[model samples]
Target: MHLNYTVGYIIPIVLDALKDTELSGDWWDIQPGVVRLCGDTVEERTKNMDKTTRRWREAQRFEILSGWRDEIYTVYAPKGSPFFYMERSAHPLFGVLAYGSHMTVYVPATPTTPLRIWVPRRAAGKATYPGMLDNTVAGGMGNGAGPWECIIKEAGEEASLEESLVRAKAKPVGFVSYFYVRHKEAGGEAGLLQPEIEYCYDMAVEAPDSGGPTLKPCDGEVAVHILMDIDEVVANLKNGKFKPNCSAVLLDFFIRHGIITAENEPDYLEIYTRLHRRLEFPTR
Candidate 1:
């Protein structure tokens, strides 16, 4: 199963929900309306929406962000009886769950010098996942857009990557299943890489630090980033890893597509052995 690649083309990215570090974009209503909220309580914020907030308003763009809209990269309408909407000019979505696109870096297994993948550390902010973890690049729904283009744009934002960089050595593989809620506050420094929102997309690069003359980051979304070894990432994942999309879908995709024959593929061959057992990792 050779992993089918998308045509050599790139899409514009808007920010939303993602879990990777090397991507450019923003999450939900956290964008242009990321105000200080001069008030003390949610009620105050709602009131402010009516009077002030010269930029945002309900039933419109601002309202679009109210409440959590996605989780683990999956969109979900508010469940059960919610405690009042988050205000239409409100993003009523809860800010407790995890929602966004994500990428996992890895060096290919091949003769001679196979590539290695590293998922550098994101900045120390409200969005960085539990302390720090290895994730490729993930972003939000980019105002309800698709994930393919989203991932590409995210790689540029978080990784300070240029389209030309990944284009030279990257290609998108099949996607995985990522089911989640809508109002979950992603773990990381809450902010956007570019000025606009973004969608989610996943791709494979030849190396972590792969860059070119056309790639650069205008916004200070990502800190110093780097690419590391997949063996270390897999080991870390096996030992209470932060996010396992790397092991869950990415690795499997590579194998399914016949990209490389991992030496330790058998030990992790539980899909066929335990087809009836439940899984314990994120998808898509």
Candidate 2:
């Protein structure tokens, strides 16, 4: 995929931060200023990067905690093992697009029924993408949690779902990946490099009238829960009403469910390939 000029510009800044670090990789001319950390083991990489992040934090004064939980996410090898740890806030500056997972719960459409998906509205005061539409339950993979673990925790925290229910119903379908470069919010400060991959899941839920399970925002992250028909969801996606990354996940859902197909979408192949772009990172 072709990146925009902004992403091209930020690549070198992230590489420069690694100068003098013990990361074992060619510093210069590695994919045009992109630094790939090659390490002997997870422990070694984690220790080295931890020191790098601390020094970078002190030297740059970058805000350390900026997410919903102000947590630290373990940077992982492509196979999903911990490589290092870094504060969520500093990820963008380093061009490290952290991995996350989310689930979309839906009532399946039958011959007589219509497909409907659960969408959550982020709280207006969210530090990022406030008031935008999001998946039913979404959270980043932290230092100690894998994708499944993270989703279960997010389900309970964001939607008050019981672990037993989520564990029983959620199925790991696939993933949607994208690279986004965000410009600075104000002034001339550097912008963020966000290359994200969402491990997407799907869960079948009882229809609203049946009251199979009630979804309420147990935490302050969400403002409300909404059940919208698949058509409406697609419309919102086209209108850019959903969070950009969330939109990619929803589009993947539609493609998998046959709601979108090659015959209908002119750019089906391109969209399909881009949604699962192969990152340089190791992913299991």
Candidate 3:
């Protein structure tokens, strides 16, 4: 029930719910319905944790556990308890967590700097997700690991990012919980979305080195990534435009880290009051 746990098929919305709530634990989003997939096979899915996970069900879990992507309710469990355990999703040996994290990445530097950030495009033949871009790094948290550990692991898997570098730049931002229910678009209340809660994190990296490992395409559902304005890009989302899900998470991260001001209203150049503002970029 920690206010950070999220319950939703969509990770960002879950985070938003957590940010919006005043309560702190085992809570869920008040969604109208669950997400549904096309055809059979992947349809009619349910949340069934393993024996180890089932054992933890009685623990005073503060977050969601074991579920699918289009699910509604997140069977929440707390940390240091057994109500949850890790298992496979999409693949048997893939070892995705019953609980996990979703995080955001920012531009290399201030808006005035000639730096940039990238977002992934949804691929051509996606199965469930058609053309919706998502976070810079996201992954299922496994059993026995901490939320920070889950985020660090996800960064490596989703973006091929370096571990220590991610750790150095990232820190906890918030949590979200996805509740279960059914809707016309989601098929039915029985067809809730997956991953009820997403532990969120935020960071500012030192613009990645080109020679470093790049973000590998996941299952052809994602297309080539892109670079654009944080504000301009996200605004496109309202018009059905495609932007990475984690972009706003990045904005949130900046806010939590005191990087983004409450007023992006004026613009990054308004800092001229002190020609000697402590704006310095380390030369690596």
Candidate 4:
């Protein structure tokens, strides 16, 4: 199925779920291997899409897939055109492309000290990837927010880093793309597709003595923040201690920093190529 020019892959279970909703009624044209919103204008499409999704949410449909985030994410076409908005939880159901931003916060090595990163552990109570290590700051881009703004917002929410600090220090360092399959850790059925693009950023922070901020758990999503040197982080990555996608972002960081190279890793070329997979859906 295609949303305008953006391809959307629907699984069999998702198709069966949609058949039980208003989405299969007048709002959408649901045919085998093809689906389209049935509306003449963007406003009409958005309205009908919202109504259909809201009904499913209220009815608690797709509960087995994932819990509703209540956050809305925009589906886009080529040239950054907004096709419509859908609830965040429903995104994986339609297998639409998802956008997010991740920032790695670290203090560069000094003559006496090695480079160290601030890593956060997800709270044990969280629904997804509980107690796993995550990037210093990461979040999904929602409600039409741009990547830069999303990063800054997530920095404060996830790590209690002030916006001024992030705005002053963060540098956009390209992105990492991946095709993810959801499983128990992701709180969804096995094999649910979630192709994602995360706008990556890196921040070289000053030591706290220089008036730089120290990470603290502001939102309950984070259990705690720890400052660990490069060696420890590499060990965790090898042990699969980080969330899979977050680990991918860290691998991107390592490659960018010249840590993972031909001399060090046998599969350096393969790993580098897979980090930026050419996605099937439209990304604007």
Candidate 5:
């Protein structure tokens, strides 16, 4: 659908299903290569869309919207433009761009130890990517929260990190952008496109004896937090143990830290380009 620009694409399955349903309201217009919402203002469009999506969620007809997270994500038209808000679960159905923040918390190498990162395993019963290894702190930017705000909230909730420590130590790095096609492994209808951007951060903590913050699972969303050596993290990434985007974030961290350099990695340039991929769609 073209808002200010092409905000999202209604895939074939979703399009056919939508066509079968009664599009009674003046909510949307579907054309050959364009789908437009009738509402002129952002508030108007959001209201109309939210009402429609609520109906879809309640009806339980659309498989993509079946497991409603109840979290609302702000959609951007091209980039830095607020378009409207949608339920997080329905984002893939429309091929919308998703944004989140991931923070890597690590202890620097000392004379007795190598640099190590705190990695969390997702709770097995979670709706998506359960039991997968993830960045130390990660959460979607929902309800209009910015990256730093999101990280601070997530750091405490997911990793049991102190807000004061996070606020004082978290360093905003760059981001990792990618175009991903969801597979069955992602626990939903396969082949849905997700052009995503992850705002990355790094937090370097002192060893436990030095009075640094320790990480533990505060919420049930994370099964456990494990501090692992850098080499172990590399091995896990090689084996696809981390969630796809989490792996990407860790790789971005490696590149930023000069651990994966042109001299050591053959695809250095390609990796750099892929990590900072320019999205065709608008972003916030």
Candidate 6:
């Protein structure tokens, strides 16, 4: 659905941080209260920005890397192959909402059964969005990995899934795009811009004894994996138990699976349109 919340104005500190960088204004466009990087190709612009952002982070002492400081995420233009790599921790500081992908796994309800979904709770000690409910498998796309590759890696790491099963069963089901301006209460520096496009996928697991592997938290990032009925999932969504973006992903699942349709919802069209809101950056 279209985001019901308003994006907060860009905080001054963010702009001030970008002021002196060689990659500022010249490499990025700041207008209409939004910031977007510009370059002929993803590689050229991303490389320049990565170097500039790294140097700025070091000089400014914004050392909250939490072990992700060395990890690199591929920054893309509006679409297509990645342009370059950037330290994962510095994405928000520069107001660049890097693109990532997520997968929703479920077992279709039989005539006598109810639909069930897999949900994971973020670890309490995580750096961002700690103790929040997340999708079955979610992660940022890093350099040299495509969407499918990224999902497989995340699925194995976060949920202990077999790579062969993931490749054989995962089905890409479009994406969910939103521009989120996180407020201080949401657990980040106030006015941190997080424009993102989540390339969503769906995986239908077989019933037990069909050789489907059980899901368990293999990585410390997830505390537990809970299987909840569709009704219970919707309840959690309404109660704000799921992370905001995860909520969007689940809502999309409902729409696509015929669980949420125009006959039952008053704002069905509006919700569908809102989920794919056209972003202003990267000229996509």
Q: CA lDDT, every prediction?
A: 0.39, 0.72, 0.44, 0.85, 0.85, 0.74
Best of the two (3, 6) by lDDT: 6
Candidate 5 residue-wise lDDT, 1-284, digit = tens: 33457877767877765654453255767778776766777798888778777776676757667678878898875547788888888888888889999999999988889889999999999878889899999998888899999999999999989899899999999899998888776877888889899999999998667887768898899999888999999999998889998988999999998889999999999998998998888778
In candidate 2 the C-alpha lDDT for residue 196 amounts to 79
Candidate 2 structure quality by residue, lDDT tens digits, 174-224:
888888666443112345667777899999999868877878999998999
lDDT of 1 by residue, 1-284 (tens): 12121111111211222111222112112324231222334344334433332223232233334332332222122332111112221222222112245565455655765445545544555242433553566665434345556666777877666667555545555444332222223331233111111122344545323442222233455444555555565566567544333344444444554543546466445542331222232112
**Candidate 1 weakest lDDT stretch, 10 residues:** 5-14
What TM-score does model 6 achieve against the real structure? Answer: 0.81
Output the number of the lDDT-best candidate: 5
Give the clash count for model 6. 7
TM-score, per-candidate, Cα-based: 0.46, 0.79, 0.49, 0.91, 0.93, 0.81
Task: Look at candidate 5 and tell me the lDDT of residue 7.
Answer: 75
- Candidate 3 lDDT, 233-279, residue by residue in tens: 54655554543223334444445545556465365344322211221
Q: Candidate 5 or 6, higher TM-score?
A: 5
lDDT head-to-head 4 vs 5, winner: 5
Estimate the lDDT of model 6. Answer: 0.74
What's the CA error at residue 258 for candidate 2, in Å?
0.6
Quote the positional error of residue 102 for candidate 6 in Å: 0.9
TM-score of 5: 0.93
Ranking by TM-score: 5, 4, 6, 2, 3, 1
Better of 5 and 6 by lDDT: 5
